[model samples]
Structure formats: structure tokens, C-alpha cells
Target: MTPHVPALPAMGVVALLRALLKRPRRPLPSALPEIVTEYRLDRLPLDDIARYRAAFGFPGEHIPLTWWYLPAQRAHLAT
Candidate 1:
């Protein structure tokens, strides 16, 4: 496999995204696929944490809310 290339093709990725997209009023499937993608930050540096906190008004242990999207988007593609 080429180091720079992903295993899934662009069309496949687009189809997956399309399939996962839904309107707010639509009901999600009760049965879900047994796929999970976990994304971890080994460490959030003190400087970065402080910068994020200062920029976003996150005072303490709470991370930026948007951070959750990384793993969620990963989970979407994995399935």
C-alpha cells in the first residue's frame, strides 16, 4: 500500500458520508454496526490547554466541545 494513500477510495468515502447523513427529524437505526473508532490525544500540553481555555473560556478540565467530533467522524468512517 502506498504510504500516502488511504485504503478506501474517494467514491467509497463519499458514499459512506452520504449514507451516514440524516435529517434531524429522521429516526436513527436501532441496530448499529459493531464498529468503533477511538481517537486519543496522548497529552494535552499545558500551553495548549491554557491557550484553548483562554481562547474559548474553558476554565478547567473541560476540553473544547468540538473535540468530540474527531472520534465521532472517525467512527462514521470506520463503520
Candidate 2:
């Protein structure tokens, strides 16, 4: 006959909490990731004002609030 293995008991909330409290937390890295990429039109993919206007749902004769950002995040990651 094959030997039977006993199932492990489930940990209670207090036990779980104690285990978590005993566990060591890793320290965060000193250097922070650069998020503030410079707002430049040259970095954008828009060829002309018309294209820029079209990208922002065709806002009539005015730039939309959301237009003031990098079109793609590739530039930010590059730095």
C-alpha cells in the first residue's frame, strides 16, 4: 500500500499577520525614474498644424488641454 501524506493546516489571520510582520521589507532604490520629459513640438509626430488639430478630435481654432504632452513615451525612456 502507498503511504498517505497529511494535509497542512491553514494559517489563521493572527498567524498570517505575525508572519508578515516578521518578514523583512526591501529598501527602495535611491535614484528616481525621470518622468518629466520636456514638452517640445519637435518630439511629436504631427507634421503640420492641421495634423495636430486632427489628433486632438479637431478642436476648432484652439489647442485642447490634452495636447500639451509627449505623443509617445519613447523619448522619456531614452533619457
Top-lDDT candidate index: 1
**lDDT, candidate 1, 41-77, per-residue tens:** 6765667656867877776777677666655687678
lDDT of each: 0.70, 0.66
Report residue 61 deviation for candidate 1 (angstroms). 9.2
| Per-prediction backbone clash count | 0, 0
Model 1 pairs in collision: none
* Model 2 lDDT per residue over 1-79, tens place: 9899998999999999998889558878899887675645554344555577886667676655555544446565666
Our model 2 lands, by Cα RMSD against the true structure, at: 11.1
lDDT value, candidate 2, whole model:
0.66
